[model samples]
Target: MKYDFDTIIPRRGTNSYKWDTPEEENVLPMWVADMDFHTAPAIVEALQERVAHGIFGYTKVPETYYDAVVRWFGNRHHWQINPRWIIYTSGVVPALSAVIKALTDSGDKVIVQTPAYNCFFSSIRNNGCELSANNLIYRGGRYTIDFDDLEAKAADPKVKILLLCNPHNPVGRVWTPEELRHIGDICLRNGVFVVADEIHCELTYGRHDYTPFASLSERFQQNSVTCVSPSKAFNLAGLQIANIIAADDEVRRRIDRAININEVCDVNPFGVIATMAAYNEGGEWLDALRKYLWENYEYLCHFFTERLPQYHVLPLEGTYLVWIDCRASGIGSDATTLRLQEEQKLMVNSGTIYGPGGEGFIRLNIACPRKLLADGLERITHILSKN
Candidate 1:
């Protein structure tokens, strides 16, 4: 590999949300989605060059930025995006909140697939919209959407938006083109707008290819909004940069207004620089990173199968997050997380926070060096084996 992903860069004193949040010393944090590895060399170099300028003024996004985004998605994923259709924002979470605010009324409803991302719930609630969960079916250690349930939910007149997590979080399943088309057809028939949070699109593994929800059809593109970012792929979450793609003119205008109203329209200079660098020159590094991440996933699966066979690790098609079934422990997800933290000083996300169908599962992030990942897994085994 051209890039080194094996090195363990110390993040404890860096005030990292994933590491510093735990007060205990020597606590291993395998919770947050952000990677333990450093970002692509190109991105780091670009940010350093910008910092050397010392201007620190508000940034005006250049045409080159749009070109990089368009070219990257077009060449890599075959999703052609017009520069005019893109709206830059601070992050995907902010973009989602703004889209919900723009598309729905105070009393309107939004449908979300559960065991979904926790932020999806907060975003919908923050915008004064009701959450209608179309829970994913968990059968035989895999998750699948209940199309009949989704169709029923979308038919409700009050349900104005269907929030989609393409290459889904927590339970990582990259929706196939056929699956995306089915979703699009249901939304189109029910007059529901689609808001696809595809921040994890570039992190897919093996045979799973991420299909941009909007790329399915012209009508789908016109009726939906997509929020994407290099933050997840490049470990640039702190940089706070993302883009919203809305092809419809009126819809784009309303979302832009909501972005400004929400006070997330402006992005920092470093974020812009890092984004352009990542999308333009970071391809090689990203490919290596995905390979490392997939290997880490396989290592985790093997670890579970050997030492912790009682817990079932779900098939990870996309994203670095792995979902493990802890039902055999006969404890709630929150308790399982607490025990891991208190007993082994290892921190991981509780599945209960991810909403329905997450109660018996625990989401573990495996985007770290093999040594660190081994330590986390050993920690889990040390604590859970007692049960």
Candidate 2:
């Protein structure tokens, strides 16, 4: 209520990756994970102060930045993080790549729950590791981890890591503590390391809670590298900053070396400021934003249920992205996305990009004003009504 989430901010000329990339004339981009809402007031004010100082030179991350991150997880998530366990990187994807390179050989395999964030595939492939997909089971309008497949894959001698998406993207299922423990136990038994990408950890809706992979147990903490960032929660992805928490000393050394080799250690000054501010002073705004995002998702679900019977909107427990099964609409995922863009001037992500189990689905980002969300839903309904 205190923030201006309803105002439509034009981003056409801002070089935004979400808005500027679409070649179409007036396409509404509900595709990307980033939100359309402005960041917290504290973050903006901190950036303004940093810019006003006017000295954009090589900078060292201050102690306060670490303290802010440490305090955030402790206060909000009840996870006590030792500041020594943290490694700064430009982004979570880069951190994932660095972790993969550091922990595994070229021929190693990485386990992933498919219908995941698309970048996980590239991060594994680009690091010269083969993808070992454990496709999640989609049933009863929700997604569940296929633990049997996960165990089988983890037992592979070549599989070295399990890249996790806690409070997962696309099919939004916030892993329960029991699920997290099961995953950690499977990896532990198979000598597979865990790389938990908890970027969407803070955006859970309702009673679903996010359990940091490291927060599960002492043994689990030792066997995992947890990635956290304020960029997704605060809509500051362009600033490019993330923290990699590696409690194991050897893994920490290897990751630090790989990050240096990749040249992603030189973080932008704005990112540092924004991250610290967002974590330290932006909790209220984040709470408000989460409420708005959840409401938008509820509206989307209701719209589909009441107006568009053919489409099945999945249960959205976390993140702003909604996964809708559009197969019943008599269209392929790619065709639906294309038609939405071309016919309705609306943009959404084709589910096939997230790997297997994603076909016949579409991922729509719902972190916008209610009016904009309504417009997108209407456009989708208009198209599906005739089907």
Candidate 3:
């Protein structure tokens, strides 16, 4: 079935964080991770059916929801997930906080790769844990793990958990299996726990492969907690559902206990139905979306190369967020975002939010209609050219 990815959806005045927040009426929001496209038909249908039943009350996560999740990872990524190992959560970010609180004590240190998802910092901080950053080595317009540095941080006794982004945000790297194994080894050796946030795992493009940290080895499985959801893949962020997969019984028990204590164990009716529908019936829609997103990436690259050669766009391996190096123009990401909003009425994420190595960069969300992407690019070109 052909999905309508090209249609421009009107989200303005819809209380959309991406579109409605800016005070400027003319501003076009190209920030935030949520896509502008509508969710898959299957998800919509499932939601509609549930709404038709009209009983909105307390809910229990059915056995079918767990089964669909198990089937999804096994069939798509060759990672077999036992239904018994899956724990429900409202969202991955909240789950991270809960996991941190449950596993590590206050004042404990958490290891985070720099230039990571901005939420990693907050999640660690909110739990009263200090951040031990192993900054990624950025060179030649790409980012790589500084393993020697990572090992050093892991060796610290206070560092009890490593909060990991599997296909890292902003820099857009789908970490290879070897890199993941090396990371797991270092964490395991140092007696540190791993929380693999794989929310964006299914959105990879081209030949890039995403390795789930838990699927690496029995030892790695025991050492890691994998967080995944259909939220990002099927555009169901509003549904607020995710899974925390822990193969170790003890780890699962602690997380499960944390879920109840935190009062986040209750699954919403819509999230449960939408998630099952997405995993079981949304494959074809996802496959087509990946192609469309890759093409959008290609278009952005070509536009920058031909019309605005000074701007450097990092190669995108996964996720629809495009990380661009704007240091050539001598503008920091915050300044760039400001000028774009004021000058061209374009809004984007300042890279500084992603942490240490993210200076002088900007992240643009390309998961929208091509017409919108082209317009944003032109506006960006105009603003940068003036600067």
CA lDDT of every candidate: 0.94, 0.92, 0.91
Error of 1 at 56 (Å): 0.8
How well is each residue in 1-387 modelled by candidate 3, as lDDT tens digits?
A: 399899999999889888889877788899988999999998899899999998999989999999999998999999998999999999998899889988999999999999989999998898899999999998887899999999999999999999989888978999999999999999989999999999999999878988788898988988999999888888888888999999999889999988998899987999999999999999999999999999999999999999888888998999999999988778688998899988899999999999998898999999999999999999999877765
- List the candidate 2 regions with Cα displacement exceeding 4 Å: none
Q: Which candidate achieves the best lDDT against the true structure?
A: 1
Candidate 3: segments with Cα more than 4 A from true spot: none
The number of clashing residue pairs in each candidate reads 0, 0, 0
Candidates 1 and 3 compared by TM-score, better number: 1
Q: Provide the TM-score for each candidate, comma-separated.
A: 0.99, 0.99, 0.98
Q: What root-mean-square deviation over C-alphas does model 3 reach?
A: 1.0
Ranked by lDDT from best down, the candidates are: 1, 2, 3
Q: Report the error of model 1 at residue 244, Å.
A: 0.2
RMSD of each: 0.7, 0.9, 1.0
lDDT of 1 by residue, 38-68 (tens): 9999988998888898889878999999999
